[model samples]
Target: MENKTTILSLFLIFLFTLPFSAQESYFPPEGEWETKEATAYQLDFAEAIEFAQDNEYSESRDLRQAILKGFQSEPYHKILGPTKKRGGPAGIIIKNGYIVAEWGDTERVDMTFSVTKSFLSTTALLALQQNLITDVNDKAGNYLWDDTFEGPHNSKITWKHLLEQNSDWSGELWGSYDWADRPPSDKNIDEWRERELHEPGTYFKYNDVRVNVLAYSLLNVFRKPLPKVLKEEIMDPIGASTKWRWYGYKDSWTTIDGLKMQSVSGGGHSGGGMFINTRDMARFGLLFMNNGKWEGNQLISEELIKEAVQPSKANTNYGYMWWLNADGPRQWENIDENIFYAAGFGGNFIIVDQKNNLVIVTRWLQPSKIEEFMQILYKNI
Candidate 1:
């Protein structure tokens, strides 16, 4: 009888504890993202796309069908292609700030890769707008800590250099099985920034570590975590609640002996570990469309929004975290110089056609001819 009572008590304790554990999150102590059902915004998919006469991009559904048909027929997309063989699936197109077309998977989440850089750019801009930091040209050493090797790199390296992909610290940023493979972790971002490197603003190398430096810089300036600042300033206000979750593996940030037990917070540009649904990305595009004012609150200044999307630093058409290319030996040359976009690995895109009031987002895992396929789709649209 005594043993039976003890076992029952343990069971009761477990039952109570189960709920607590289930509700626990690895995202650190933060406010829960209030959940709400997503409402669909009406958009005509087809008419505007096929028939150029409808300049307004009205027939969104027809455009959607065309995208579907292309997905089925396009050799590059390989609708039936194996998982590893393809870059991903479904091309999402949001026109006039509404989802007008889709090809491949329907709102499936995929690793955003470098597009996270664009998101990071948004965060950096937000920091600047909030006056948390005065200048993008501020030296890395100003906000980040010091190190002998990385100091030269840090002193000359400004936030703009990082944003423009011109940082010298970027010895290896992209490619496979090289220095590029191992992105700088959330821990030691400052140390990495301070590592010995040549003069900053000297070249255009796609480095992922620069963005980590940017993140750390922002956190240091605000005296708070980047994730928390981002949530309050950027994500929540803009309705990016659903798919926007900051990554921090486990026991994300803690301390031991006054040292940073948890070094880094998230990934950098040229690569980020962002996982979000298609709808929320479209919503983010919408936030840019609405002048960065979500529900009447100015999340980002109109001036900053324009700068973030339009090319400012390099001639390569990279804006903040967005990529604004003008017919770069690709298919979509007709696009006005004003067109800007955010492209990710596995052929994902969030394109904004400022002239047409359009935002097109496409995410896929197509293997065969990734770039060719994407360019073809853009031209066709």
Candidate 2:
């Protein structure tokens, strides 16, 4: 009996000393990253591939030609710069920091449209973190003394309001009017243009002109081109590729503090936003999923992230520039509420699901089918 008891104790020690079956973290180093089978993460490989193939966009119209036609007819289309030829359906599913599944030309750099807003938002957050300006609620007029932040209606706007897209900032930015963007189809042009301006923070309107104004203000605050700020601070640290580019219109350049600076756009409404590949997008999503940390370095504060994803009172579905899956009419179905994404026009999305340690980047997918695709993706996990 004594011998048996000693043997059992030795067996338990050995078992406990062995490594557990844990998911491997394969954060790509510089330019090299490895792919793993989906089954390694307990995902059904066949189902994932099937889901990807079945959910492909099946539009009757040629997508790029249609997009070009639509954008060319916009009121301020000329100011939007040129629309780039977009790539076909492409995406990468990253699980536990490894590429578990990918399809299409994942390396092809393509226009990311409005997803640039999230990066713009991050730049603003970086400003806050660096104490360039104190408090997000502080009035914008304090830092930006130009007419852009002037007047009765615009004077009341705050950094927080701009971040949330509820500033109701009444002005012309980069030759684009605030009311001209996605004007209410139900109302006459005059009625929509002459409508009373809602007080900042009390109403939400997704106007690219206003978003451009935010980008312009950030350019002033940073005292440098927005892209340089993004690259030196966020992108470089996260090991993002150099392929991504942010663009502003030809007229958007201006003299600031004795230096010529180009104010970038917050989205691709007129044209030119982030043109990045799926891998770069995945790196960005992974950075957010790790709570703004990468490779044991805290890139952006967790506090900023908390505020970035917090639901706006005006639009519960939006926070800062990141879309929140809040309890609202536009909420996604059957997914973790904590999952947030940077969505762009033309079905470009960088979805961050921290709950499941997943980052999904899909480009040129059917926008309406996104929720269903996610539902299917999660089911495999």
Q: Give the clash count for each candidate.
A: 38, 1
Please list all clashing residue pairs in model 2, or write none if there are none.
80-270
lDDT of 2 by residue, 1-381 (tens): 999999999988887775331233456776766788888767864554566656655542343554556565345445355457766778888877888888888888887878999999999999999999799999988997677878889899999999999999887877788877778768877887899999999999887888888888888888899999999998888888888888888788988779998888887767767778888899999898878888878889999988899999999999999998878877888878888999988788999887778888988787888887777777755
The number of the candidate with the highest TM-score is 2
lDDT per model vs. reference: 0.52, 0.82
- So what's the TM-score on candidate 2? 0.90
TM per prediction: 0.63, 0.90
State model 1's lDDT.
0.52
Question: Model 1, range 220-268, lDDT digits (tens) per residue?
Answer: 5666655666677776666564545454323334343455532232331
Instruction: Tell how far residue 335 is off in model 1, in angstroms.
Output: 2.0
